[model samples]
Target: MVVLTKRELEQIALPAVQLAAPPLALVPEVDLSAVEASDAARSAAARAVAKACEDHGFFKVTGHGVPAPLLARLDAAAAAFFALPQRDKDKAAAGAGGGSPPFGYASKRIGDNGDLGWVEYLLLGVTAAGAAAAPVALSEGAESSCFRDVLDEHIAAVRRMTCTVLELMAQGLGLDDEGVFSRLVLDRDSDSLLRVNHYPARPEAAGEPAEVRRRLTGFGEHTDPQIISVLRSNDAAGLEMSLRDGTWVSVPSDTRSFFVNVGDALQVLTNGRFRSVRHRVVVSSARPRVSVIFFGGPPPRQRLAPLPGLVDREGGRRRYRDFTWREYKTSAYRTKLADNRLCYFETTATS
Candidate 1:
């Protein structure tokens, strides 16, 4: 966590804009059970996932096969870890040192570029080998050992669920191969990461509208740069996602289910067929919000561009230039969290 001085705090505070409330209807949802059922059932589910991706670029997921007790254990473990003193928590992720943009613990600050938030997070890299080895500081103690165990189980289950969702996405897109999307994420060198975020409770005081004009941003709006992201959060209502129309809507939190959103890579791969949702979190009430998100990215060396199948078919034209995940990732790291990192890669023509 980056410590803030008085001058820094002023810069970190921003007014939360009050946007229009979305329709009463919640985001569309997909159930994973059908994928394991009859062929007809699978088709129906696949169409639903496809439609949600094309229309909203986001959806809620159910029947994901992860046990509620397991998630509860995860929450308990996370809470225990965060409740520790700052010094102890710092020692936990101190292994790789900071500013790698790869993994470890962070608080208040979002990235190296000074984007601050009312959030603290633990980010761990996972590959074919296993969940990231528990940091040395965390593994030394009995309690931390249990945290590591719960963390391992949680990552294993989430990874499987995420891959299944990706497969369904392929089916929905009418792709000939279901594994096309899933295989990249499962590669031995995949840069997939799991982030456990805790938003501390900050009660909003009732006061003159002018006095409350400024709101603390729990997290600023930004699009996930990976192919997809799977997110689960406790029953805290701090999440807000932007709609196609540019209006922001509050996403009601449900601890039992997960939320899925498209990322920039998917947008490019689909040649603009799907959109990457921009989202943020705000500290609204006295309750705190804890969210766990898994970002599934391809290997750093994997080249990214609109799939030839999409571009060459139906007179489609390439909208983006080819680049490796490493190139894009490096570019994204240099910018602010809210910058449209994809814009630079877009192709344009002159008469």
Candidate 2:
């Protein structure tokens, strides 16, 4: 919310001279079009996904079948909603109940420490039954009745693509049950969250040197707690990932493609064969950026552990202990966003 004026936006805009060049050779791109093609083609695509998951836990996806017009419409709607005043945006707030899930507009200050990110977001929950249980209402000032319709269509399309991707990943891992991954995520009670993020330009800090101010981050480093996350963003680059070597690589913003990242749950299911990506968003002085992310997880009551098949194949060693989605999520929410939530669930042998 908090409709920012042109002058206010400009005040936070980073100067072009301070912008860093995009990093190279970070994450590879996988073509989803090959997923349903000939066996050889599908296998090749699966191999690419496997490699990306094992090495970086992140990859870009093209030919995902999401219409360009639909993506544009979703972006336009989000921009319009975020441009409204704070009071107007709060009409659909997550509500005052202490037990409410984090499912609506979350402003800058979040976490126990009141850490501030230069971003604001609207979170909507979707179930396997169909679209969001409570569909997001378009702000009246948005002046477009079609906004909600387009958004719903977009969410539906992405969910289909998410399931397909999971199937491919399962095949890539040599799983006999092709639907194992898909079933875990598409269950009727699964909590699939769609987050629409708006990262405004960084404001100039008085009396601080330009170099020092440029070091501020929009969001601190962290890994997702779900099975996977699919993200689409505008051309303003800010996302970065931590490599195994401890180097941080910037991910170029490519609006036409979706970036997929493995999450903690997937890592456990794969018996640590796959990795969970640790990444962060850096604030830019250029222009404000917008991104839409879909995070998929298992049903709240579903017990999660390294697959028995994977464990038996790997000398019967379990990397993580069995835990329910409810337990994992509770632990995740109780700590700072940047903390490594997976550490809390590691098997005692590994610990």
Candidate 3:
């Protein structure tokens, strides 16, 4: 487990610009079924997904079989969790997760360098047992049992979808059909963490016009560093990703679909075959927004590096030096999260 001191988190540098674009383009609403069959279609899907990943590192997935009822229940539960009074929410604050760096509630505006994003969060991690251990149920009282049941179902569905998408990525990268998923996601302690976020609209003053302060929000530009991230956002739009040419594009929640993005860890395991896009959320003045993300990855101590096959062969010689995933993550977690320089190192370790 890792713990981030207030001083350490306070030292991180925010993006130089307040609103920056991500590094790619977004291929909105892709059908999961269309890409699951035939080598040719899979190849094409791979190419398209790869291109989108390379360009923006983020895309929208649709036609996934996750039941709509599940999504509704999850969303409602998320709302209930965030709706708790500040005091109740603080009961599960970050430090309570036995010193784990990424769990529990995190208030907005506490990040390094005064980067003020308008959101609060409660983070959860899943173990191989197929369910996240109940660190602290929303409420021990039965009134919130529905929240627990619905959230449990939603997590299961997200885990399944995560495996399906990762398998496709493996096939697209020309590895064995079950390649990446098995290697990157160890069944026992794979990271299937969840981040339940609340992006509050900018507060209005007593008599101040509400419209003037309506456009504030939840987060700033960044990318997930894990394998894949499945996210569900409220109607308010603030999530944005970067493009290859350096433009940040907005990713809005559509219908019942969840937003998916490739993370830095996957890029390394695939030897840079895929990319992790930069993204951030903005605060709003009306209607608070809540989002939950399921992050996929190996255990904390797993050594992460680009697959040798993707490294040495055709194009450029191996681009990064091999390093343990935990080592790299430790550095990232210890320092400013924006510094991506060390994530790609070159060394003569393994093939």
Which candidate's TM-score is highest?
A: 1
RMSD over all Cα atoms, model 2: 4.5
lDDT of 2 by residue, 1-351 (tens): 334455544444445553553465457989888777899999898888888899889999999999998998888888888887777667557532221557667776555554556678877787575465564644554453565576668778988888888888988999998889888778988878888888876655445555555633566678998999999998887888888776778888899999999999999899899989898887745478899998888999999999888888877888899999999988888888778889888875632
- Name the candidate, 2 or 3, with the larger lDDT value: 2
lDDT per model vs. reference: 0.81, 0.78, 0.65
Q: Tell me how many residue pairs clash in candidate 1.
A: 0
Residues 67-137 of candidate 3 have per-residue lDDT tens digits of 98778777777777778777767766644334365566667653444554556777766657555546543
C-alpha TM-score for every candidate: 0.91, 0.88, 0.83
Q: Whole-model lDDT, candidate 2? A: 0.78
| Best-matching candidate per lDDT | 1
Better of 2 and 3 by TM-score: 2
Higher-TM-score candidate of 1 and 3: 1
TM-score of 2: 0.88
Model 2 lowest lDDT segment of ten: 92-101
Q: List where candidate 1 sits over 4 angstroms from the true fold.
A: 1-10, 19-25, 96-102, 133-136, 203-214, 349-351
